[model samples]
Target: MLKKVRGTRKKATLGHIRQETVYLAIQALQKDESLSIQLLCEIAGIARSSYYKWLNRKPSACELENEQLTQVMLSIYEKVERTFGYRQLTLHMRKQTGKKINHKRVYRLMKLRGIQSVIRRKRAKYVRSTPQQVAENVLNRKFEATAPNEKWVTNVTEFKYGHGQKAYLSAILDLHDKSIVSYVLGHSNNNPLVFQTLKQALQAAPGSKPMLHSDRGFQYTSLDFKKLLDKNELFQSMSRVGRCIDNGPMESFWGTLKCEKYYLHKYETFQDLKKDVENYIHFYNNERLQAKLNGLSPMEFRNKAA
Candidate 1:
């Protein structure tokens, strides 16, 4: 009669027992004095033989190492706010621990842990504008440069903070090392904002005549902007109307900045937003490693080349 009652209870509870739950019950047997081995096995819909086998089996060396590596990956994942995918995380883990960890292994471990990088938000559509005049597409998608300041691309991106207030970021990227030569944040995307960005770049790299490329924005097409470029003897190049990819490198940088940093937070004040933008740019130049640059940051690549 007792055996019949036990069978009925076990059958009723077995439907709810998952493999994960069975594992948990096995673990609990070690800590809970009231959980008898036989009862756990019955409740988990597993044979006493299977429970004993799992309990006596020791983890392999590879399994133990994978557990440890998963913990390290978690630390890095949180440190970067999950901004890095498995590839970048692997590079970072190798640098920090000097362990020649394979990226494939890292990818497998990250998958098991359900750790992943953030998804990038798609950028807004480009508004085609008819300019009175535009410079030749002198850049012609020749994005690579053999030396610093040889080819430069400039663009302005907008950000919002606190009740629809907008901030404009104008910056120049040197194609040689992908470094931001100069950047300016302003309340308005006016001619002055772009001019100041240009002025700063000119001052930063005095006597360097480079091809400066930009989109057909009003500021970039202005007469004043042309005069300033001519004064510095810079070759002015403009992207075709609605063709953002003409300045692909510069657009790529913006996407990186937005995906990795700007989109991660909300700012209540312009001051807070500006401070974060400045910090991210500094990190990008100094700390963030690039695969194309042989795992060096932008500034590192530039300095090594120099």
Candidate 2:
């Protein structure tokens, strides 16, 4: 050694005397040919009576109960692809098994077993910046409509699967009913898909020229899209660049679609994804409840308006 260290030398001092004694006793027993209660107590620096007391006592009822609870938690975790966290697991236990288990117990059990939900990593993607020649915000964030075809919001959202293949979903939602007036799923993020969706929305709206709102995606701002809007006599409204709140309702719809449906299910093919989307859209329009619509579905709201 370069120098002899003296003083208290607190840098590497053992934190707990009891823990150190326990570890030392374990080490001594491993080296010993046989273990005896008296010898263990001597090595642990504890009284022999205390060691005998621990050996004679049985596990508490609560300890036994925790073992049973842990088994149930393990079963539920295995059943759900290890994706259910404490809250979801608790909910599943109550609903599926009719067990009134405490959340704290579930949390403790999940922690003890090292069972955890997988978190999806956020991916960075290319977002088109708003053009320098920004349009006036005509819609002004008015999301409610008294009848179908009064207000509509359109947006393009991208999805990808496996090896670099991406698909764009362009859709128009009727604010009056919270229903998808039109939607198109396509391989390319081009004007054709956007125009096709708009055409379908116009057809669905029949005689109405709805105020169409959308983020300034190239598809929305293209000459062809503008010409179609002008020919249809529809009011065009663009959201301010990067201001999601300007088009909050459509953003909310997209979030719900991704979180509640898309994130949970994996698609192997574009057609499969399209079919699932179609089914979900139908359910959203005709069956899913909307709190703003007094808990009625989009189709119900439309019928009520009629």
Candidate 3:
């Protein structure tokens, strides 16, 4: 039987006293040569039976493994700068440690240790649609694509900096890789920004008349925009009025970008914010790991497929 417990052992000894506690009291008397067991137990406030029981108790294998797991969780959480929630953290843990873990246990361990990702709330924002009829919902919330450029989604989001100053970002996303094929930023949230993004996407991907989808914003419904689509033989699709979920993937991307990077920083100028946004897009494509992507970045997944 062990005479002493490691420092990590619980101090609570209920039933009989522990051998470790009795040994401790004896050792103290040996060192001091004057303190009695009664005085030691009185000062320690542990009954003799409780101290004896604690010293005799041995840790189970499962309990020992849990301590190890907590350390691993802390290592990975700091390594990623705490960008991942429990799901992604579980993936990283399993990948690095080669240990199969139930995700619920990971969640529990993270909670117990107070290790968690930053939680940021999302809100809905949109431009009002035009009165005229827009393109039909050909895609109809079917976001999957087997090949690049098979389906493309486009949208513009607004950003503010420098006290009431504003900027707009127009981006085109490919359904297959969830990659931003092209993007453009401008002071005006108008036809020019969208057109530039669309044209760049066309040049970059050069798909076989891919279905270009968007909401029925006035920029999308404009005669020139439709003519541009018609001229390029790009089929157009639109979300119905008041249904942002029709563009769920695109909306989710904005929220992820904001939560992971944007909301964490203080941007004093449009130029500084724009540069960081550009850097984040690159990182999202090449460095950031996604749970849906099977632990690969978007570019890594696409390249692996190729």
Candidate 4:
């Protein structure tokens, strides 16, 4: 009779253990972690052998927490406008949560979630203008001059607005000191445009008939432009067709202007663009340092020379 009573107590205890196991498995499933029979057994302090007995069990609290982290990562990617790759996303996560996470983990998450960026292609190419008559290559790529106004190169470039409106920029650069002797902004890039720039340059450098060089653009070949050069007693030089090397200094000036300042900002009106261009030219001459001038600005180097 005592042995039978002991057996009954043992059976009741086993029944209680099974009920607790079922309750833990349900809790694990709600938590969203990888809920398997094995994980549930581990959470409930049961043996692996015992877990296999309940092979069709659900997820535990740990698995649920892992799923929540993934959802949070996805939300972050969406919030950043989908532009951020894994590195940036990882940084964002750390900043938001104050928790340091590995970049590789973030990358893997992004890959699994299929994140990417859109690629853009070039729009159009500029065609070089063909001139009726080519001018002589007088300077022959010699960029240096001993005195101011000895050698000058001129060029014009255009900036576009929405559909049809545009502004033209003409510049005359003194190659000797690499200074912008004169510049003009106009509605059209024509003979009048460049001739006006040349007139200003000639007036600025009084008593000097500089050897002026330019590309074979039509503006440079126009009769009015040539007559003005003749009137000032300045010799005319030109680059060979499609050969930018002949007017390398002027080309370099254009490159520096566009790359350093103009390309970075969008101009709303022609006048605003003109004002900014003037400001940049002033800065280029007076403030901005040039490696070619031994770390001195054009104005500084020229002043020292004087």
RMSD of each: 9.5, 11.7, 9.4, 19.5
Estimate the TM-score of every prediction.
0.82, 0.61, 0.74, 0.58
The TM-score leader among the candidates is 1
Model 3: per-residue Cα lDDT over 1-306, one tens digit each: 243563223333321124433455565674688766656666667676665565476857975786788788888787656767888778777877789977877876775555678887767566576445489989899998988778999888878778888888999888888888899978889999999999998888765678999988889989889999999999999998888899888988888877777777778898988997898899788777677777777898789877
The residue pairs that clash in candidate 2, if any, are none
What does the lDDT come to for candidate 2?
0.74
Clashing pairs in 3: 16-49, 17-49, 17-50, 17-51, 17-52, 17-53, 18-51, 18-52, 18-53, 19-52
Q: After superposition, how far is residue 1 of candidate 3 from its true place, in Å?
A: 37
Give the true-structure RMSD of model 1.
9.5
Worst 10 residues of 3 by lDDT: 7-16
lDDT of 4 by residue, 18-137 (tens): 654465454557467656655666766767675454444575794455456568777876653454466556655665566666776676555444565323222233576666555789
Name the regions of candidate 3 deviating beyond 4 angstroms: 1-72, 75-81, 97-99, 124-133
Q: Candidate 4: where are CA atoms >4 Å away?
A: 1-132, 162-164
Q: 3 or 4: which has the higher lDDT?
A: 3
Q: For each candidate, how many residue pairs have backbone atoms clashing (under 3 Å)?
A: 0, 0, 10, 10
Among all windows of ten consecutive residues in candidate 2, which has the lowest summed lDDT? 6-15
Alpha carbon lDDT of residue 89, candidate 2? 66
Give the candidate order by descending TM-score: 1, 3, 2, 4
Q: Write the number of the candidate with greater TM-score, choosing between 1 and 2.
A: 1
Expressed as tens digits, the lDDT of each residue in 55-167 for candidate 1 is 67798898788788888889888877788898888877887778889987797777665578888888877566567569989888988899999999999999999999999
Clashes of 2: 0
